[model samples]
Target: MRTLAAIVLICTATAPQAHPHIFIDTGLTAIVDDAGALQAVKVTWAYDAFYSLLITEDYGLDPDGNAVLTPDEEAQLRGFDMQWIEGFDGDLVARLDGGSLELSRPRDVTLVMREGRLVTTHVRDVAGTPAMAGHILSMKPFDPTYYTSYDVTMNVRVQGLEGCAIVRNLPDLDAGMQQLQGALTKLGRDQDAIEEGFPEVGEAFATEVEITCADR
Candidate 1:
Protein backbone atom coordinates (compact mmCIF):
# COMPACT_ATOMS: atom_id res chain seq x y z
CA MET A 1 0.00 0.00 0.00
CA ARG A 2 1.31 3.40 -0.88
CA THR A 3 1.41 6.05 1.80
CA LEU A 4 -0.34 9.42 1.53
CA ALA A 5 3.00 11.12 1.16
CA ALA A 6 3.73 9.02 -1.89
CA ILE A 7 0.48 10.12 -3.48
CA VAL A 8 1.44 13.77 -3.07
CA LEU A 9 4.86 13.12 -4.53
CA ILE A 10 3.36 11.35 -7.52
CA CYS A 11 1.04 14.24 -8.20
CA THR A 12 3.87 16.73 -8.11
CA ALA A 13 6.18 14.69 -10.30
CA THR A 14 3.77 14.60 -13.20
CA ALA A 15 4.07 17.90 -14.99
CA PRO A 16 1.30 19.71 -16.75
CA GLN A 17 -1.03 17.44 -14.86
CA ALA A 18 -4.60 17.52 -15.98
CA HIS A 19 -6.79 19.75 -13.92
CA PRO A 20 -8.11 18.28 -10.69
CA HIS A 21 -6.78 14.79 -10.13
CA ILE A 22 -7.42 15.57 -6.46
CA PHE A 23 -10.50 17.38 -5.20
CA ILE A 24 -10.81 19.26 -1.95
CA ASP A 25 -13.57 21.04 -0.15
CA THR A 26 -11.88 24.01 1.46
CA GLY A 27 -13.01 26.47 4.11
CA LEU A 28 -11.65 29.65 5.65
CA THR A 29 -12.26 31.16 9.02
CA ALA A 30 -11.00 34.49 10.27
CA ILE A 31 -9.42 34.61 13.71
CA VAL A 32 -9.45 37.69 15.81
CA ASP A 33 -7.29 38.87 18.66
CA ASP A 34 -8.67 40.15 21.96
CA ALA A 35 -9.10 43.60 20.46
CA GLY A 36 -11.27 42.20 17.64
CA ALA A 37 -8.55 42.75 15.09
CA LEU A 38 -8.11 40.04 12.51
CA GLN A 39 -5.03 37.96 13.26
CA ALA A 40 -4.93 35.06 10.86
CA VAL A 41 -6.94 32.90 8.54
CA LYS A 42 -7.65 29.29 9.39
CA VAL A 43 -7.68 27.18 6.25
CA THR A 44 -9.21 23.74 6.22
CA TRP A 45 -9.02 21.32 3.33
CA ALA A 46 -11.01 18.07 3.28
CA TYR A 47 -10.17 15.55 0.61
CA ASP A 48 -12.89 13.83 -1.36
CA ALA A 49 -13.88 10.28 -0.60
CA PHE A 50 -12.00 8.74 -3.51
CA TYR A 51 -8.74 10.44 -2.60
CA SER A 52 -9.34 9.65 1.05
CA LEU A 53 -9.71 6.01 0.17
CA LEU A 54 -6.42 6.05 -1.67
CA ILE A 55 -4.74 7.59 1.36
CA THR A 56 -6.32 5.15 3.81
CA GLU A 57 -5.31 2.22 1.66
CA ASP A 58 -1.77 3.54 1.49
CA TYR A 59 -1.79 4.00 5.26
CA GLY A 60 -2.89 0.35 5.69
CA LEU A 61 -6.30 1.19 7.04
CA ASP A 62 -8.91 -1.48 6.56
CA PRO A 63 -11.58 -1.08 3.93
CA ASP A 64 -14.16 -0.85 6.64
CA GLY A 65 -11.99 1.43 8.71
CA ASN A 66 -13.68 4.57 9.98
CA ALA A 67 -10.49 6.57 9.23
CA VAL A 68 -9.55 7.30 12.81
CA LEU A 69 -5.86 8.00 13.41
CA THR A 70 -3.92 6.87 16.46
CA PRO A 71 -1.49 9.27 18.11
CA ASP A 72 1.51 7.99 16.21
CA GLU A 73 -0.40 7.92 12.96
CA GLU A 74 -1.49 11.45 13.58
CA ALA A 75 2.10 12.53 14.11
CA GLN A 76 3.25 10.83 10.96
CA LEU A 77 0.47 12.43 9.01
CA ARG A 78 1.27 15.86 10.37
CA GLY A 79 4.92 15.40 9.54
CA PHE A 80 4.02 15.25 5.87
CA ASP A 81 4.46 18.98 5.69
CA MET A 82 2.65 20.43 2.69
CA GLN A 83 4.69 23.56 2.19
CA TRP A 84 4.81 25.38 -1.11
CA ILE A 85 8.04 25.51 -3.07
CA GLU A 86 10.39 28.29 -2.15
CA GLY A 87 9.15 31.68 -3.47
CA PHE A 88 5.78 30.17 -4.26
CA ASP A 89 3.06 32.50 -2.98
CA GLY A 90 1.00 29.44 -2.06
CA ASP A 91 -2.39 28.26 -3.24
CA LEU A 92 -4.37 30.37 -0.83
CA VAL A 93 -4.61 33.78 -2.52
CA ALA A 94 -5.93 36.77 -0.69
CA ARG A 95 -6.13 40.54 -0.88
CA LEU A 96 -6.66 43.10 1.83
CA ASP A 97 -7.74 46.62 0.98
CA GLY A 98 -7.13 45.92 -2.68
CA GLY A 99 -3.52 44.94 -2.03
CA SER A 100 -2.28 41.38 -2.15
CA LEU A 101 -1.27 40.12 1.26
CA GLU A 102 1.88 38.06 1.51
CA LEU A 103 0.72 35.31 3.83
CA SER A 104 3.23 33.49 5.95
CA ARG A 105 3.63 29.76 5.64
CA PRO A 106 0.90 27.83 7.38
CA ARG A 107 1.55 26.99 11.00
CA ASP A 108 -0.07 24.58 13.48
CA VAL A 109 -0.69 22.06 10.75
CA THR A 110 -2.82 19.05 11.60
CA LEU A 111 -4.40 16.20 9.73
CA VAL A 112 -7.21 13.91 10.74
CA MET A 113 -9.66 11.40 9.38
CA ARG A 114 -13.27 12.36 9.79
CA GLU A 115 -16.24 10.30 8.66
CA GLY A 116 -13.91 8.46 6.32
CA ARG A 117 -12.55 11.67 4.83
CA LEU A 118 -9.06 13.13 5.24
CA VAL A 119 -9.07 16.66 6.56
CA THR A 120 -6.02 18.90 6.97
CA THR A 121 -5.82 22.33 8.52
CA HIS A 122 -3.38 25.15 9.25
CA VAL A 123 -3.23 28.85 10.02
CA ARG A 124 -1.68 31.59 7.84
CA ASP A 125 -1.06 34.79 9.64
CA VAL A 126 -2.00 38.04 7.99
CA ALA A 127 1.25 39.96 7.36
CA GLY A 128 -0.30 42.73 9.38
CA THR A 129 -3.83 43.44 10.45
CA PRO A 130 -4.91 46.91 9.67
CA ALA A 131 -7.92 48.70 11.11
CA MET A 132 -10.41 47.10 8.76
CA ALA A 133 -13.58 48.85 9.83
CA GLY A 134 -14.75 49.32 6.26
CA HIS A 135 -12.32 47.22 4.30
CA ILE A 136 -13.09 44.21 2.13
CA LEU A 137 -10.91 41.15 2.16
CA SER A 138 -11.17 38.71 -0.70
CA MET A 139 -9.64 35.25 -0.88
CA LYS A 140 -9.52 32.24 -3.15
CA PRO A 141 -7.57 28.99 -3.16
CA PHE A 142 -6.47 27.79 -6.57
CA ASP A 143 -3.64 26.05 -8.34
CA PRO A 144 -2.36 28.04 -11.25
CA THR A 145 -1.40 24.74 -12.82
CA TYR A 146 -4.92 23.49 -12.38
CA TYR A 147 -3.63 20.25 -10.92
CA THR A 148 -5.98 20.30 -7.93
CA SER A 149 -9.50 21.58 -7.53
CA TYR A 150 -10.56 23.51 -4.45
CA ASP A 151 -14.14 24.25 -3.48
CA VAL A 152 -15.59 25.91 -0.43
CA THR A 153 -17.94 23.87 1.70
CA MET A 154 -21.44 25.08 2.43
CA ASN A 155 -20.62 25.10 6.12
CA VAL A 156 -18.14 27.98 5.83
CA ARG A 157 -18.16 29.87 9.10
CA VAL A 158 -16.67 32.90 10.78
CA GLN A 159 -15.14 32.58 14.20
CA GLY A 160 -14.47 35.17 16.95
CA LEU A 161 -16.63 37.87 15.44
CA GLU A 162 -20.33 38.65 14.98
CA GLY A 163 -20.58 41.16 12.14
CA CYS A 164 -18.63 39.25 9.59
CA ALA A 165 -20.17 37.66 6.50
CA ILE A 166 -18.88 35.64 3.58
CA VAL A 167 -19.97 36.37 0.06
CA ARG A 168 -19.00 33.68 -2.41
CA ASN A 169 -18.59 34.20 -6.13
CA LEU A 170 -19.67 31.55 -8.54
CA PRO A 171 -17.49 30.43 -11.40
CA ASP A 172 -17.74 32.29 -14.67
CA LEU A 173 -18.82 29.56 -17.03
CA ASP A 174 -18.34 31.44 -20.29
CA ALA A 175 -14.81 32.38 -19.33
CA GLY A 176 -14.01 28.88 -18.15
CA MET A 177 -15.39 27.27 -21.29
CA GLN A 178 -13.44 29.71 -23.39
CA GLN A 179 -10.30 28.87 -21.50
CA LEU A 180 -10.91 25.19 -22.06
CA GLN A 181 -11.43 25.73 -25.76
CA GLY A 182 -8.22 27.65 -26.00
CA ALA A 183 -6.30 24.94 -24.22
CA LEU A 184 -7.73 22.28 -26.44
CA THR A 185 -6.85 24.26 -29.51
CA LYS A 186 -3.33 24.78 -28.28
CA LEU A 187 -2.95 21.07 -27.69
CA GLY A 188 -3.55 20.55 -31.42
CA ARG A 189 -4.52 16.87 -31.30
CA ASP A 190 -1.63 15.94 -29.06
CA GLN A 191 -3.90 14.37 -26.47
CA ASP A 192 -0.95 12.96 -24.56
CA ALA A 193 0.61 16.37 -24.09
CA ILE A 194 -2.51 17.85 -22.50
CA GLU A 195 -1.46 16.59 -19.15
CA GLU A 196 2.15 17.64 -19.66
CA GLY A 197 1.64 21.08 -21.19
CA PHE A 198 -1.59 22.39 -19.75
CA PRO A 199 0.26 23.80 -16.76
CA GLU A 200 1.55 26.57 -18.97
CA VAL A 201 -1.98 27.68 -19.75
CA GLY A 202 -2.31 29.03 -16.22
CA GLU A 203 -5.40 30.17 -14.28
CA ALA A 204 -7.43 27.15 -13.12
CA PHE A 205 -10.45 29.30 -12.33
CA ALA A 206 -11.69 29.68 -8.74
CA THR A 207 -14.62 30.73 -6.61
CA GLU A 208 -13.75 33.89 -4.75
CA VAL A 209 -14.73 34.74 -1.19
CA GLU A 210 -15.45 38.24 -0.10
CA ILE A 211 -15.09 38.66 3.64
CA THR A 212 -16.76 41.71 4.97
CA CYS A 213 -17.02 43.11 8.45
CA ALA A 214 -19.43 45.83 9.39
CA ASP A 215 -17.97 49.02 10.75
CA ARG A 216 -16.95 48.42 14.36
Candidate 2:
Protein backbone atom coordinates (compact mmCIF):
# COMPACT_ATOMS: atom_id res chain seq x y z
CA MET A 1 0.00 0.00 0.00
CA ARG A 2 1.22 3.51 -0.75
CA THR A 3 1.81 5.99 2.04
CA LEU A 4 -0.19 9.21 2.36
CA ALA A 5 2.88 11.27 1.66
CA ALA A 6 3.60 9.28 -1.43
CA ILE A 7 0.07 9.75 -2.68
CA VAL A 8 0.39 13.48 -2.17
CA LEU A 9 3.65 13.54 -4.03
CA ILE A 10 2.20 11.65 -6.95
CA CYS A 11 -0.82 13.91 -7.19
CA THR A 12 1.21 17.07 -6.93
CA ALA A 13 3.84 15.91 -9.37
CA THR A 14 1.29 14.82 -11.90
CA ALA A 15 -0.97 17.79 -11.26
CA PRO A 16 -3.80 17.86 -13.81
CA GLN A 17 -3.16 14.25 -14.78
CA ALA A 18 -3.90 12.60 -11.43
CA HIS A 19 -4.58 8.91 -11.73
CA PRO A 20 -5.11 6.09 -9.30
CA HIS A 21 -2.06 4.01 -8.42
CA ILE A 22 -4.15 1.15 -7.03
CA PHE A 23 -7.38 -0.31 -8.34
CA ILE A 24 -9.78 -2.64 -6.58
CA ASP A 25 -12.92 -4.47 -7.56
CA THR A 26 -15.34 -4.14 -4.68
CA GLY A 27 -18.36 -6.18 -3.53
CA LEU A 28 -20.83 -5.57 -0.75
CA THR A 29 -23.33 -7.75 1.06
CA ALA A 30 -25.69 -5.97 3.38
CA ILE A 31 -26.78 -8.11 6.28
CA VAL A 32 -30.20 -7.59 7.79
CA ASP A 33 -31.77 -8.87 10.97
CA ASP A 34 -35.07 -10.75 11.22
CA ALA A 35 -36.65 -7.45 12.17
CA GLY A 36 -35.77 -5.96 8.77
CA ALA A 37 -32.93 -3.86 10.15
CA LEU A 38 -29.39 -3.70 8.87
CA GLN A 39 -26.94 -5.54 11.11
CA ALA A 40 -23.70 -5.69 9.17
CA VAL A 41 -22.00 -5.41 5.82
CA LYS A 42 -19.54 -7.79 4.23
CA VAL A 43 -17.00 -6.15 1.94
CA THR A 44 -14.87 -7.93 -0.59
CA TRP A 45 -11.92 -6.44 -2.43
CA ALA A 46 -10.05 -7.99 -5.34
CA TYR A 47 -6.86 -6.12 -6.04
CA ASP A 48 -5.43 -5.68 -9.51
CA ALA A 49 -2.59 -7.88 -10.65
CA PHE A 50 0.09 -5.22 -10.32
CA TYR A 51 -0.83 -4.31 -6.76
CA SER A 52 -1.28 -7.99 -5.87
CA LEU A 53 2.20 -8.72 -7.12
CA LEU A 54 3.56 -5.87 -5.05
CA ILE A 55 1.85 -7.18 -1.93
CA THR A 56 3.03 -10.72 -2.53
CA GLU A 57 6.59 -9.55 -3.01
CA ASP A 58 6.45 -7.15 -0.05
CA TYR A 59 5.31 -9.95 2.25
CA GLY A 60 7.87 -12.37 0.83
CA LEU A 61 5.09 -14.75 -0.11
CA ASP A 62 4.76 -16.84 -3.24
CA PRO A 63 8.52 -17.37 -3.36
CA ASP A 64 7.95 -19.82 -6.17
CA GLY A 65 5.91 -17.19 -8.08
CA ASN A 66 3.07 -19.58 -8.76
CA ALA A 67 0.55 -17.26 -7.10
CA VAL A 68 -0.25 -19.96 -4.57
CA LEU A 69 -0.01 -19.33 -0.87
CA THR A 70 0.61 -21.98 1.74
CA PRO A 71 -1.38 -22.15 4.95
CA ASP A 72 1.34 -20.29 6.82
CA GLU A 73 1.60 -17.69 4.07
CA GLU A 74 -2.13 -17.15 4.10
CA ALA A 75 -2.07 -16.79 7.87
CA GLN A 76 0.63 -14.15 7.59
CA LEU A 77 -1.26 -12.33 4.85
CA ARG A 78 -4.51 -12.16 6.77
CA GLY A 79 -5.22 -8.79 8.29
CA PHE A 80 -2.22 -7.31 6.50
CA ASP A 81 -4.35 -4.51 5.14
CA MET A 82 -6.29 -4.00 8.35
CA GLN A 83 -3.58 -1.98 10.02
CA TRP A 84 -5.29 1.30 9.25
CA ILE A 85 -4.16 4.63 10.58
CA GLU A 86 -6.39 6.82 12.70
CA GLY A 87 -9.47 8.39 11.02
CA PHE A 88 -9.41 5.85 8.24
CA ASP A 89 -12.91 4.59 7.43
CA GLY A 90 -11.75 1.53 5.51
CA ASP A 91 -12.88 3.35 2.35
CA LEU A 92 -16.51 2.54 3.10
CA VAL A 93 -19.27 4.92 4.02
CA ALA A 94 -22.77 3.96 5.06
CA ARG A 95 -25.58 6.42 5.49
CA LEU A 96 -29.17 6.20 6.64
CA ASP A 97 -31.63 9.01 6.08
CA GLY A 98 -28.75 11.26 5.04
CA GLY A 99 -26.87 10.66 8.28
CA SER A 100 -23.75 8.61 8.76
CA LEU A 101 -24.06 5.09 10.12
CA GLU A 102 -21.41 3.91 12.51
CA LEU A 103 -19.69 0.71 11.53
CA SER A 104 -17.58 -1.50 13.75
CA ARG A 105 -13.99 -2.38 12.93
CA PRO A 106 -13.55 -5.13 10.41
CA ARG A 107 -13.80 -8.71 11.68
CA ASP A 108 -13.80 -12.16 10.17
CA VAL A 109 -11.11 -11.19 7.68
CA THR A 110 -10.19 -13.67 4.98
CA LEU A 111 -7.49 -13.44 2.35
CA VAL A 112 -6.61 -15.48 -0.70
CA MET A 113 -5.08 -15.25 -4.14
CA ARG A 114 -7.65 -15.64 -6.90
CA GLU A 115 -6.53 -15.81 -10.52
CA GLY A 116 -3.30 -13.98 -9.69
CA ARG A 117 -5.12 -11.26 -7.77
CA LEU A 118 -5.25 -10.72 -4.04
CA VAL A 119 -8.82 -11.04 -2.80
CA THR A 120 -9.91 -10.27 0.73
CA THR A 121 -13.19 -10.08 2.60
CA HIS A 122 -14.21 -8.71 5.97
CA VAL A 123 -17.38 -8.06 7.92
CA ARG A 124 -18.21 -4.76 9.57
CA ASP A 125 -21.10 -4.84 12.01
CA VAL A 126 -23.35 -1.86 12.20
CA ALA A 127 -23.07 -0.13 15.53
CA GLY A 128 -26.84 -0.39 15.94
CA THR A 129 -29.60 -1.91 13.95
CA PRO A 130 -31.13 0.61 11.56
CA ALA A 131 -34.61 -0.23 10.35
CA MET A 132 -34.75 -0.51 6.61
CA ALA A 133 -38.42 -0.02 5.81
CA GLY A 134 -38.73 3.57 6.88
CA HIS A 135 -35.34 4.86 5.85
CA ILE A 136 -32.99 4.85 2.90
CA LEU A 137 -29.70 3.04 3.21
CA SER A 138 -26.83 4.18 1.02
CA MET A 139 -23.31 2.87 0.75
CA LYS A 140 -20.19 3.90 -1.12
CA PRO A 141 -16.70 2.43 -1.09
CA PHE A 142 -14.11 5.02 -2.06
CA ASP A 143 -10.72 6.53 -1.33
CA PRO A 144 -11.17 10.24 -0.73
CA THR A 145 -7.64 11.01 -1.89
CA TYR A 146 -8.19 9.32 -5.28
CA TYR A 147 -4.93 7.37 -4.94
CA THR A 148 -6.94 4.17 -4.78
CA SER A 149 -9.88 3.57 -7.09
CA TYR A 150 -12.74 1.24 -6.15
CA ASP A 151 -15.10 -0.31 -8.68
CA VAL A 152 -18.29 -1.89 -7.37
CA THR A 153 -18.44 -4.56 -10.01
CA MET A 154 -19.33 -7.61 -7.90
CA ASN A 155 -22.53 -8.96 -6.46
CA VAL A 156 -24.53 -6.72 -4.17
CA ARG A 157 -27.13 -8.46 -2.05
CA VAL A 158 -29.32 -7.81 0.96
CA GLN A 159 -29.64 -10.83 3.18
CA GLY A 160 -32.54 -11.60 5.55
CA LEU A 161 -34.65 -8.83 4.08
CA GLU A 162 -37.60 -9.22 1.79
CA GLY A 163 -38.93 -6.61 -0.64
CA CYS A 164 -35.71 -4.69 -0.50
CA ALA A 165 -34.12 -3.69 -3.78
CA ILE A 166 -30.64 -2.40 -4.42
CA VAL A 167 -30.11 0.52 -6.78
CA ARG A 168 -26.76 1.44 -8.27
CA ASN A 169 -25.93 4.95 -9.46
CA LEU A 170 -22.73 5.19 -11.42
CA PRO A 171 -20.84 8.44 -11.65
CA ASP A 172 -20.76 10.49 -14.80
CA LEU A 173 -17.17 10.18 -15.90
CA ASP A 174 -17.30 13.08 -18.36
CA ALA A 175 -18.54 15.46 -15.73
CA GLY A 176 -16.30 14.03 -13.08
CA MET A 177 -13.27 14.41 -15.30
CA GLN A 178 -14.13 18.00 -16.02
CA GLN A 179 -14.53 18.65 -12.31
CA LEU A 180 -11.20 17.02 -11.56
CA GLN A 181 -9.46 19.09 -14.20
CA GLY A 182 -10.90 22.30 -12.82
CA ALA A 183 -9.85 21.37 -9.32
CA LEU A 184 -6.38 20.50 -10.48
CA THR A 185 -6.07 23.79 -12.28
CA LYS A 186 -6.94 25.62 -9.08
CA LEU A 187 -4.49 23.51 -7.11
CA GLY A 188 -1.75 24.21 -9.62
CA ARG A 189 -2.10 27.91 -8.95
CA ASP A 190 -1.58 27.37 -5.25
CA GLN A 191 2.00 26.57 -4.35
CA ASP A 192 0.84 24.91 -1.12
CA ALA A 193 -1.54 22.45 -2.75
CA ILE A 194 0.76 19.58 -1.90
CA GLU A 195 1.11 20.64 1.69
CA GLU A 196 -2.56 21.59 1.91
CA GLY A 197 -4.14 18.57 0.25
CA PHE A 198 -5.27 16.99 -2.98
CA PRO A 199 -8.89 17.52 -3.91
CA GLU A 200 -11.12 14.71 -2.66
CA VAL A 201 -12.51 13.61 -6.01
CA GLY A 202 -12.93 9.94 -5.28
CA GLU A 203 -16.56 10.36 -4.36
CA ALA A 204 -17.09 12.02 -7.69
CA PHE A 205 -16.11 8.79 -9.40
CA ALA A 206 -17.75 6.35 -6.97
CA THR A 207 -20.76 4.18 -7.56
CA GLU A 208 -23.44 4.63 -4.95
CA VAL A 209 -25.66 1.75 -3.80
CA GLU A 210 -28.99 2.43 -2.22
CA ILE A 211 -31.37 0.01 -0.56
CA THR A 212 -35.09 0.60 -0.52
CA CYS A 213 -37.50 -1.62 1.34
CA ALA A 214 -41.23 -1.98 1.01
CA ASP A 215 -43.36 -1.39 4.07
CA ARG A 216 -44.90 -4.41 5.68
Candidate 3:
Protein backbone atom coordinates (compact mmCIF):
# COMPACT_ATOMS: atom_id res chain seq x y z
CA MET A 1 0.00 0.00 0.00
CA ARG A 2 1.21 3.50 -0.85
CA THR A 3 1.34 5.81 2.13
CA LEU A 4 2.09 9.47 2.72
CA ALA A 5 5.09 8.55 4.86
CA ALA A 6 6.61 6.64 1.95
CA ILE A 7 6.17 9.65 -0.31
CA VAL A 8 7.69 11.93 2.30
CA LEU A 9 10.71 9.66 2.66
CA ILE A 10 11.33 9.57 -1.06
CA CYS A 11 10.53 13.24 -1.80
CA THR A 12 11.84 14.84 1.41
CA ALA A 13 9.28 17.62 1.04
CA THR A 14 5.92 17.85 2.75
CA ALA A 15 3.79 20.53 4.36
CA PRO A 16 4.29 24.34 4.20
CA GLN A 17 4.82 24.34 0.43
CA ALA A 18 2.04 21.84 -0.35
CA HIS A 19 3.61 21.27 -3.70
CA PRO A 20 2.12 17.94 -4.69
CA HIS A 21 4.54 15.17 -3.87
CA ILE A 22 2.87 12.74 -6.24
CA PHE A 23 1.42 13.81 -9.59
CA ILE A 24 -1.08 11.86 -11.67
CA ASP A 25 -2.70 12.69 -14.96
CA THR A 26 -6.24 11.40 -14.68
CA GLY A 27 -8.96 10.31 -17.13
CA LEU A 28 -12.58 9.34 -16.43
CA THR A 29 -14.97 7.40 -18.64
CA ALA A 30 -18.60 6.69 -17.82
CA ILE A 31 -19.53 3.05 -18.42
CA VAL A 32 -23.00 2.53 -19.78
CA ASP A 33 -25.12 -0.56 -20.38
CA ASP A 34 -26.77 -1.62 -23.65
CA ALA A 35 -29.86 0.42 -22.77
CA GLY A 36 -27.77 3.57 -22.12
CA ALA A 37 -28.00 3.70 -18.37
CA LEU A 38 -24.79 4.58 -16.58
CA GLN A 39 -23.47 1.56 -14.64
CA ALA A 40 -19.96 2.39 -13.52
CA VAL A 41 -16.95 4.62 -13.93
CA LYS A 42 -13.58 3.69 -15.38
CA VAL A 43 -10.70 5.79 -14.13
CA THR A 44 -7.17 5.88 -15.46
CA TRP A 45 -4.32 7.21 -13.38
CA ALA A 46 -0.89 7.77 -14.89
CA TYR A 47 1.75 8.64 -12.39
CA ASP A 48 4.64 10.99 -12.92
CA ALA A 49 8.16 9.73 -13.51
CA PHE A 50 9.44 10.56 -10.05
CA TYR A 51 6.66 8.79 -8.22
CA SER A 52 6.74 5.97 -10.73
CA LEU A 53 10.30 5.28 -9.72
CA LEU A 54 9.29 5.17 -6.08
CA ILE A 55 6.44 2.75 -6.68
CA THR A 56 8.61 0.53 -8.84
CA GLU A 57 11.19 0.32 -6.11
CA ASP A 58 8.64 -0.28 -3.36
CA TYR A 59 6.83 -3.04 -5.20
CA GLY A 60 10.03 -4.91 -6.17
CA LEU A 61 8.93 -4.89 -9.78
CA ASP A 62 11.33 -5.67 -12.57
CA PRO A 63 13.53 -7.62 -10.22
CA ASP A 64 15.43 -9.05 -13.17
CA GLY A 65 16.64 -5.57 -14.14
CA ASN A 66 15.27 -6.16 -17.62
CA ALA A 67 12.33 -3.76 -17.20
CA VAL A 68 9.90 -6.59 -17.92
CA LEU A 69 7.48 -7.80 -15.28
CA THR A 70 7.36 -11.52 -14.51
CA PRO A 71 4.06 -13.34 -14.11
CA ASP A 72 4.25 -12.98 -10.34
CA GLU A 73 5.11 -9.31 -10.67
CA GLU A 74 2.15 -8.86 -12.98
CA ALA A 75 -0.11 -10.52 -10.46
CA GLN A 76 1.15 -8.26 -7.69
CA LEU A 77 0.63 -5.25 -9.87
CA ARG A 78 -2.92 -6.26 -10.75
CA GLY A 79 -3.76 -6.94 -7.11
CA PHE A 80 -3.05 -3.46 -5.83
CA ASP A 81 -6.06 -2.76 -3.65
CA MET A 82 -7.74 0.64 -3.30
CA GLN A 83 -10.73 0.71 -1.01
CA TRP A 84 -12.30 3.68 0.77
CA ILE A 85 -10.47 4.82 3.89
CA GLU A 86 -13.29 4.30 6.33
CA GLY A 87 -14.51 7.72 7.53
CA PHE A 88 -12.20 9.69 5.27
CA ASP A 89 -14.01 8.38 2.21
CA GLY A 90 -12.05 7.47 -0.89
CA ASP A 91 -10.05 9.70 -3.15
CA LEU A 92 -12.77 9.56 -5.80
CA VAL A 93 -16.16 11.07 -5.00
CA ALA A 94 -19.35 10.62 -7.01
CA ARG A 95 -22.81 11.92 -6.38
CA LEU A 96 -26.16 11.40 -8.10
CA ASP A 97 -28.92 13.85 -7.41
CA GLY A 98 -28.61 14.79 -3.71
CA GLY A 99 -27.20 11.47 -2.46
CA SER A 100 -23.63 10.25 -2.59
CA LEU A 101 -22.93 7.23 -4.73
CA GLU A 102 -21.07 4.30 -3.25
CA LEU A 103 -18.15 2.77 -5.12
CA SER A 104 -17.25 -0.91 -5.00
CA ARG A 105 -13.68 -1.96 -4.48
CA PRO A 106 -11.70 -1.33 -7.63
CA ARG A 107 -12.04 -4.07 -10.23
CA ASP A 108 -10.18 -4.93 -13.42
CA VAL A 109 -7.07 -3.35 -12.00
CA THR A 110 -4.14 -3.15 -14.36
CA LEU A 111 -0.66 -1.68 -14.12
CA VAL A 112 1.73 -1.01 -16.91
CA MET A 113 4.78 1.08 -17.59
CA ARG A 114 4.27 3.67 -20.30
CA GLU A 115 7.08 5.88 -21.51
CA GLY A 116 8.96 5.14 -18.29
CA ARG A 117 5.95 6.07 -16.16
CA LEU A 118 3.50 3.89 -14.28
CA VAL A 119 -0.08 3.79 -15.54
CA THR A 120 -2.99 2.14 -13.76
CA THR A 121 -6.50 1.43 -15.01
CA HIS A 122 -9.46 0.29 -12.98
CA VAL A 123 -13.26 0.33 -12.82
CA ARG A 124 -15.53 1.08 -9.89
CA ASP A 125 -19.18 0.25 -9.94
CA VAL A 126 -21.57 3.02 -8.97
CA ALA A 127 -23.02 1.21 -5.96
CA GLY A 128 -26.31 2.13 -4.23
CA THR A 129 -28.22 3.18 -7.38
CA PRO A 130 -26.77 2.21 -10.75
CA ALA A 131 -29.31 3.24 -13.35
CA MET A 132 -28.62 6.89 -13.98
CA ALA A 133 -31.24 7.24 -16.69
CA GLY A 134 -32.46 10.77 -16.02
CA HIS A 135 -30.25 12.19 -13.30
CA ILE A 136 -27.07 14.22 -13.32
CA LEU A 137 -24.06 12.61 -11.68
CA SER A 138 -21.11 14.65 -10.46
CA MET A 139 -17.67 13.26 -9.77
CA LYS A 140 -14.16 14.31 -8.79
CA PRO A 141 -10.95 12.50 -7.69
CA PHE A 142 -8.83 14.32 -5.18
CA ASP A 143 -7.12 14.04 -1.83
CA PRO A 144 -8.87 16.40 0.53
CA THR A 145 -5.69 16.88 2.53
CA TYR A 146 -4.12 18.34 -0.62
CA TYR A 147 -1.54 15.57 -0.49
CA THR A 148 -1.34 14.16 -4.00
CA SER A 149 -2.24 16.43 -6.91
CA TYR A 150 -4.34 15.18 -9.84
CA ASP A 151 -4.46 16.75 -13.29
CA VAL A 152 -6.48 16.02 -16.40
CA THR A 153 -4.68 17.28 -19.46
CA MET A 154 -6.92 15.62 -22.03
CA ASN A 155 -10.64 15.97 -22.61
CA VAL A 156 -12.77 13.87 -20.24
CA ARG A 157 -14.57 11.23 -22.32
CA VAL A 158 -18.10 9.80 -22.14
CA GLN A 159 -18.60 6.35 -23.60
CA GLY A 160 -21.87 4.96 -25.07
CA LEU A 161 -23.41 8.42 -25.13
CA GLU A 162 -23.92 9.14 -28.77
CA GLY A 163 -25.93 12.33 -28.26
CA CYS A 164 -25.13 13.37 -24.71
CA ALA A 165 -22.48 16.05 -24.04
CA ILE A 166 -19.80 16.46 -21.39
CA VAL A 167 -19.21 19.64 -19.42
CA ARG A 168 -16.14 19.84 -17.18
CA ASN A 169 -15.60 22.43 -14.46
CA LEU A 170 -11.87 22.59 -13.93
CA PRO A 171 -10.52 23.49 -10.55
CA ASP A 172 -9.31 26.99 -9.90
CA LEU A 173 -5.79 26.25 -8.68
CA ASP A 174 -4.99 29.76 -7.47
CA ALA A 175 -8.13 30.05 -5.39
CA GLY A 176 -7.62 26.51 -4.13
CA MET A 177 -4.11 27.27 -2.95
CA GLN A 178 -5.43 30.26 -1.09
CA GLN A 179 -8.05 28.08 0.54
CA LEU A 180 -5.33 25.65 1.59
CA GLN A 181 -3.33 28.45 3.10
CA GLY A 182 -6.32 29.60 5.09
CA ALA A 183 -6.99 26.11 6.34
CA LEU A 184 -3.39 25.64 7.36
CA THR A 185 -3.37 28.97 9.11
CA LYS A 186 -6.48 28.15 11.09
CA LEU A 187 -5.20 24.76 12.10
CA GLY A 188 -1.72 25.96 12.95
CA ARG A 189 1.03 23.35 13.25
CA ASP A 190 -1.19 20.67 14.66
CA GLN A 191 -0.42 17.14 13.56
CA ASP A 192 -3.88 16.55 12.17
CA ALA A 193 -4.23 19.90 10.46
CA ILE A 194 -4.51 18.80 6.84
CA GLU A 195 -6.62 15.74 7.56
CA GLU A 196 -8.98 17.71 9.75
CA GLY A 197 -9.54 20.52 7.27
CA PHE A 198 -9.82 18.23 4.26
CA PRO A 199 -13.51 17.34 4.47
CA GLU A 200 -14.53 20.99 4.39
CA VAL A 201 -11.90 22.41 2.06
CA GLY A 202 -10.64 19.61 -0.20
CA GLU A 203 -13.31 19.51 -2.90
CA ALA A 204 -12.56 23.13 -3.74
CA PHE A 205 -9.37 21.88 -5.35
CA ALA A 206 -10.95 19.01 -7.30
CA THR A 207 -11.87 19.02 -10.97
CA GLU A 208 -15.66 18.84 -11.19
CA VAL A 209 -17.42 16.36 -13.47
CA GLU A 210 -21.10 17.13 -14.07
CA ILE A 211 -22.75 14.81 -16.60
CA THR A 212 -25.93 16.13 -18.08
CA CYS A 213 -28.33 13.41 -19.12
CA ALA A 214 -29.81 13.53 -22.59
CA ASP A 215 -33.48 14.43 -22.79
CA ARG A 216 -35.80 11.52 -22.18
- Model 2 scores a TM of 0.87
Q: Is candidate 2 or candidate 3 better by lDDT?
A: 2
Off by over 4 Å in 3: 1-19, 63-72, 81-88, 128-130, 186-200
Report the alpha-carbon TM-score of model 1 versus the true structure: 0.79
lDDT of each: 0.67, 0.82, 0.67
Model 2 residue 141 CA deviation (Å) reads 0.9
Which candidate tops lDDT?
Answer: 2
lDDT by residue (tens digit), candidate 2, 120-143: 999999987888886788999998
Top model number, TM-score: 2
Per-model TM-score, in order, reads: 0.79, 0.87, 0.76
Per-residue accuracy of model 1 over 172-213 as CA lDDT, tens digit each: 645654564466455444355544455432343577888887
Which residue pairs of candidate 1 clash? 16-195
